[model samples]
Target: MGDVVRAPWDAYFVTGFDTCSEVLRGRNWLAPDFAWQERQDDPERWGAVATQEMTKTLSRLNAPEHTCQRRSLGNLFDRSTIQRLTPVIEEHSARLLDDLAEKLRWGEADFVSTVSEQLPISTIGSWLGVPAADHPHILEITHNQVYAQELLPTKSELATSAEATGHLRAYFTEMVRQRRAKPGNDILTGWIHHWDAREPDRETADEILYRLTMFVTIASLETTATLLSAMVGLLLGEPGRWAWLRENPGHIDAAVDEVLRYDPPIQINTRVAAEDTVLAGVPIAKDSMVHVLYGAANHDPRRTENPDAFDIERRGTHLTFGGGVHYCLGAALARLEARTLLIQLLERFPTLRVTTPPVYASRLVFRRVTSMGVSI
Candidate 1:
């Protein structure tokens, strides 16, 4: 068990792996009640407009409502659906790697821009049926929107994020319109059909659809990019790890899992007490904020042997995608993207080298690499 540490603003932090798991899986704990209201008041608080919009998303909903939306959306991300997209992921990875190789010929390249950032956003944009030409705009909007979640935003930052959010909403609205008129074989089209079948009033259904689309788009892009960047930094940090990966390409899945465990993308998850209750012997009040320190739990020695060591062969799971009803909808997609990129990279450049140390981003909720220089 872990101690309950007090956080700023009278909130509590849950650090034990088992306890955190309990909190995540428990139905009594719920999404923070004031999350949306807080974001609405100060648009720059967490994710600005994006966070404000997500206040209405499935992740923020309770039981029956969450259950319905999750079930309907679940089919879109099932194993078979994700498996069919492998070739698309591979094609994107190969193209990005080809670009990286060309940049390396000029001595060095910024891997974060050339590969880490580009691959995930591009792949996700394609998956969402965003035209290739519109990907850059969407990526810019999502990057600004997602980065705002890292810290309390400045007035200027908040203004910029709010503007980006408007652009995103406009874009999504147009896409939704297009999907409704002429359905396609894309995830968004599937979601639209699902929402339509629900038969809710037009305004209510549209609101739900737009919010859900924004939530999925931002979540998929930001976390996937963060994971890829972190994996690259970790692999290249040690002397033999890169070469080891090249020799043991079969270990890519385990390596990806290990990376998720050692350095998860989203570091903290928050919940609020739905009713007055005791947790791990601690007293609780309704609506009290409880922070689940996923990063800390992942590193907890009691649950993981040699927790600090980055052993790819470690045989266990981490809370990187969270757990229970709120588990990440894109978990499989993320793993597939990472595995595809790593395999393709190792096969293409057997002697990958880090040209410079990686610079990490400073954020409260997410661990990300801002830039890294590398060469083949």
Candidate 2:
């Protein structure tokens, strides 16, 4: 593919590192918000409930609305908050790893289910004050809802996403009511307070808080878990790597960074030309959709030396968390969780080995590792 390749479906795909970065940071590029979707030729595709629901998320909004919605949660992942959550993350990692160790005592344990899936949700769930008991249910709905975020979702997947979105709306709406009635010291309560101060209408404030909460959960859960599983699986797959990490614990940060570059969770990000522009010497019209391939960009030989090989010592950056305004807000938290968990996991199960290859779900945007069998 050239810097920009036109798809058969009439969309543009940006595959080069420089071109992808250019589009992401370009002021003329906009995410596919409600306005953009409305202008599309396919009304049925654009008008789907799942599509409409996505426009309200922080990931899809443009300019002022994106800025305003983002500002409301400015302090959510600040340095102080991450510092405060370190111990909580460690505690959850330790407990989850302990459970994994127990399961390994009998036979092979699925790391994805036993540890990766549990740690991220537990850590984020605790921070948001969502009950531990509801983690499984929330995880299910998020999985279903993510289908709509794929590069090419079928009508069936869209329907599933719509149903999931409805359940999420109802679940979070009630949670918002409960929090308003009996507020706590959690992030959700803090968001409610933030919105209440700005929005005059109580209903409007709650609605804002609902979207914020839902975004936080969906953003933090699956991707981080996939990252955790990928990091562990990659390290264990290479003989002596896990032991080397245990001996050289100082390299945990670098290891995590390399994993992010090698096997990023989100592969592609969608945006529309806000105005007529030329990218890589190619003219693009306004309202044309562009899909920036993050995974491809991360592996571009021009930007990275031996791009396909996984080397923990490499300090190259990755577009896994994206770039520019839509850069992942929970990036620090995700890194913290990964580093904390990896450190403990190496210390506890240095002998852990992958007995079977990891199983990834079929999707173009989000890389979901459904199962990875491991043995001690």
Evaluated with lDDT, which candidate comes out highest? 2
Please provide, for model 1 over 183-279, each residue's C-alpha lDDT reduced to its tens digit, 9 standing for 90 to 100: 8877787777777779568766777778788788888887888899888878877889889888888789999999999998899888888789988
Model 1 residue 255 CA deviation in Å: 0.4
TM-score, cand. 2 vs. native: 0.98
Kindly provide the TM-score of model 1 when superposed on the true structure, using C-alpha atoms: 0.92
Off by over 4 Å in 1: 33-50, 147-157
Error of 2 at 167 (Å): 0.8
Q: Which residue segments of model 2 deviate by more than 4 Å? A: none
lDDT string for model 2 (100-184, tens) is 8899999999999899989989988898788999999999999999998987789999999999999999998999999999999
TM-score top scorer: 2
TM-score for each of the candidates: 0.92, 0.98
For model 2, give the 10-residue run with minimal summed lDDT: 38-47
